[model samples]
Target chain A: MTDVLELRDVHRTHGDGANAVQALRGVTLTVRPGELVAIMGPSGSGKSTLLNLAGGLDRPTGGEVLVEGASLGTLSHRRLSAVRRRTIGYVFQDFNLLPSLTAAENVALPLELDGKSIRAARRAALAALTEVDLADLAHRFPDEMSGGQQQRVAIARALVGERRLVLADEPTGALDSQTGEAVLRVLRERVDAGAAGLLVTHEARHAGWADRVIFLRDGVIIDSSGPLGSADDLLERTS
Target chain B: MSIRHGLLALLERGPMYGYQLRAAFEESVGGTWSLNIGQVYTTLSRLERDEFVLPLPENDGGQRPYEITGTGRAELARWFATPIERTDRPRDELAIKLALAMTTPGVDVAAVVQSQRTAGVRALQEYTRLKTRQDKQAQDDLSWLLVLDAMIFQCEAEIRWLDHCEATILRRTRTARPAEQAQTPEPHPVRKEARR
Candidate 1:
């Protein structure tokens, strides 16, 4: 199957010269269609950096990032923005919804920004919301919805249109346990329906939604394991 | 999780032979928990001995089925009515490990905490994965879903506890260090300088 998102020896360094901090040091990963890969690591382990790079919000200083077989580094600024708006979806810990927009409008924003007609965008947004079982709340604003509901709207927004790569950073960080699980259920459903996902989370329970998990430390990939692999093996090596 | 109660509950529905009982129990729990036929037979015998169940006449196939007794039905009702007490849980090895690590002379308590946290996280991941697959395959299996949810919640709680342990240990170490420094005599300036 084609990879929905691929990072080939990707490196991102902040600042320059003596002040340079290598946030991601030659990290490589691939998330294929219908796959959800979880990235887990300590703070400053480049989890967010990796997500940002995948989502085209940040550029890698070295190597390549490809979404849907198109190299992100080769794209022009305008083209990259278009790629992000149409092909990549992002769910942040904070939900990142515009307070002024209703749930459906927030979900439709990406499609609209990508030049889809407003009517078409709204229709797609409602469909996405319905996929997440939030169609009834499509008219509600962010503040009007519960944290779980807002996160679901965020997921619906990410999943709207033909966006095949979903990047989530601690998407459940702000919700209660039951609500967090509910959001994960929707994310898992979306991935199972053929969208590839890269979820960066510190919580293992949330990562359990993924088929595989990659552990990072000091900006390096330390270990990767499948759902059935014994986590004790990884712990022994790390400790 | 309780095989005794599980068997009784199955018997409540209808009489079933050993293999049937085992199959029903496994099915109800979504195959997440497997049961051995030998264990089932052993439990059935014990139940018969206790008058909680009675062995019925062998069918044409010669398979003897066990039927729940009136007392068994009452017991099942009591089990359902009573909440499981926390005291009934087994000793927590992780908690004990952390407590011992704090007092052990050569143990790296932080590493211990880290390892436990990693294991907890992994278990949580595995449970969640199971839940996702199970939900997709058997969306209406409430018994299995509940079992999976219980494990997920417990694993989450364990990770949280491990985090709490690490933070508390760090705080205690920080507070204790100054006192230890005050009690220890300062090295002679010449010796300290030579060591440096």
Candidate 2:
């Protein structure tokens, strides 16, 4: 399958040479359709930087980023934003929902930003909300719903349309374990249904949901590994 | 974690012959631990000797079922109430390997840490995958779910410890011992850029 997200030897440095900090250094990764790749590292390890570069929220100082075979490096600012709005879905720790809007409206925001018709956007938003199992609360405001519900709304917003590449940074940071797992389940389901996903989390348990894990250290990927060993191997070894 | 306690717990549910007990044990734990008939019989014999279970007369199929005794009930209750001691676990090989790597000559400690972490994360992911599947089941099955959670938490803790070991080792190597005061010349000091 063609990769929905690709970063070829990507590098991101802040400030001038003397005072520079390389947030990402020569890192390369790929997320194909139906794949969820996790980025795990301590703070300042370039996880967020890598996610931004992947989503075109930030440009790489060197190397290339391609989403769906289109190089992000060469896209115009307007075109890039359009791609970000149209194709990329972002879920952050904080729900990031507008307090004034209802759940449906919050989910519809991304589609609307991409110049989708309000009615069409609402339809897609409702479908996305239903996928997250929160369709009945479509008219509820952010404050009215719990954190998990709000986060699911944010996820619905992120994946409202054909947004194929979902970039989530600590998306489950604020919820309890059960709620957090539920949120991850939704993300995993989306990925399993053919969208590619990139999850940035410090929690190893959350990273377990991904097909592969990339460990970043000092702005570089030290190791990338496939889904952990089978559950049986663990029991046998430990026993 | 003990087969003895596991058998006692299963017998507390109801009477079962050696074969039935083995199948129930495997099915209850999701087949993570398989018990042979010999082991089951050995444990049952031990349980019978200890008066924790009473074996009945052989049935039509030559199956002799056992029931949990009052002492067995008390033992199972105690097992449930008492906390598991950390010292009860087997020696962690990763811990020993890392300690040896730090002290012994010519060991790339960071490499050891990374490789172990790779395996650790893989196992952690698998537990999470199983946990996810378990969550979707119509039945709650609390005991099995808790079992999965324990593995996930322990795996997370081990990985965190490995990360701590790597960081501590790196810091000490860089700060406490410079090349000037080094015991000997480095055998194969890995350059950071070379790894990229």
State the C-alpha lDDT per candidate: 0.86, 0.90
TM-score of 1: 0.77
Q: TM-score of model 2 relative to the true fold?
A: 0.92
Model 2 per-residue lDDT tens digits across residues A15-125: 977999989899988899999999998887899999989999889999999999999999999999899999999998998999999999999988888888999999999
**Which prediction has the highest lDDT against the true structure?**
2
Q: How well does each candidate superpose onto the true structure, as a TM-score? A: 0.77, 0.92
Which residue pairs come into collision in candidate 1? none
For model 1 chain B, the run of ten residues with the poorest summed lDDT:
B113-122
Model 2 residue B111 CA deviation in Å: 0.9
**Candidate 1: fraction of native contacts reproduced:** 0.31
Give the clashing pairs for model 2. A228-B122, A229-B122
Candidate 1 DockQ category?
A: incorrect
What TM value does chain B of candidate 2 have? 0.84
Residues A1-239, model 1: lDDT tens digits: 89989899999999999999999999989999899999987688899999999998999999999998989999999999898888888999999999999999999988888889999999999999999999999999999999999999999999999888899999999999889989888888888889998999988778767888887877998776665475334323322
For model 2, residues B1-196, the per-residue Cα lDDT tens digits are: 7899999999988999999999898878776777889999999999999999999999999899999999999999999999999899988887888788889999888899888888878988888887777778736687777877888898889889987887787777788777656656555456555666
